[model samples]
Target: MKLGIVRCAQTEEVCPGSKDFQALREKTGVFAKVDDAIELVGFTTCGGCPGKKAVFRAKSLVAAGADTIAFASCITKGTPIGYPCPFAKRMIAAVEGNVEEGVEVLDYTHGW
Candidate 1:
């Protein structure tokens, strides 16, 4: 399964997202439970508040062949530092609305 990851821009300086990438590579959390091998297609931010940029980013990922969009645990679960994204829900909705049918939008890429 080709997947795209969306992370919190606020945590970019504090977290490099190495753990999230490692978890995804190791097939941890939901990835481990899935049957197919997960391929990372793209990684990007929600483009700050209101997440207006996320819709386009998601569409771009889908266009790049990402069949699933996974919101990194930093945005949803708040791993490591416990600072979750405030606009996660809205960002998710925008991505969901933009992506095509059958493209899975996962709330989290890994667990805390």
Candidate 2:
């Protein structure tokens, strides 16, 4: 599975996404469910709070060869900030609508 990661722009400054990358490398977290060989198709942000550009970014990632769009833990689990995105559900729905059917959307990259 080719994966695209969307992180939180605010978290980007404080976190390096080490846990997310580690989970992908070790097949932990959501990666454990991926039976196929995973590829790092893309890694980017949600365009800050409210995630205004997530839909476009998702489309871009899919176009760039990602079969799956994985929201980074910083967006879902919140991680170091301890506060998940308030717009996560709506943003996810928007992305799901923008992507083609069968393109998997994961709620998180790594949860910790």
Candidate 3:
């Protein structure tokens, strides 16, 4: 299962946190854990609030071979920020409803 990770678009540079998808990928070994069952084939941002193009990007990723789509914990889990991104939620819905029917959409978050 090819996986795609979507994160937030940061404009202001600052000391990054564990919220970073790449950092989490390294720490969690998500790809390695899944091994040949999954591949991190696509990565991108949700284009911030409103996330107008998110669905399109997700579709493109799926078209490119992503069998599953995942949002970074920071966006879905609401870690550090204390609130989940409305745009991310919207993107998830859009991707779920509009993308390929069987593609899996995952939220790398906890605590709802």
- lDDT string for model 2 (1-112, tens) is 9889988999999999899999999999999877778899899999988999999898889999999999998888889799999999998999998898999999998768
Residue 60, model 2: lDDT of 89
lDDT of 1 by residue, 8-72 (tens): 87788888888778878888876878778888999998877757788888888899999999888
Best model number under TM-score: 2
**Runs of candidate 2 exceeding 4 Å displacement:** none
TM-score of each: 0.91, 0.96, 0.70
Q: What residue pairs are clashing in model 1?
A: none
Name every residue pair that clashes in candidate 3: none
Residue-level error in angstroms, candidate 1, position 102: 1.0
Please give, for residues 3-71, the per-residue lDDT of candidate 3 as tens digits.
777765542133143344444355353333454444678777777776777788788889889888877
Ranking by TM-score: 2, 1, 3
In candidate 3, which residue ranges exceed 4 Å CA deviation?
11-36, 109-112
Residue 106 local lDDT, model 2: 94
Candidate 2 lDDT score relative to the true structure: 0.91
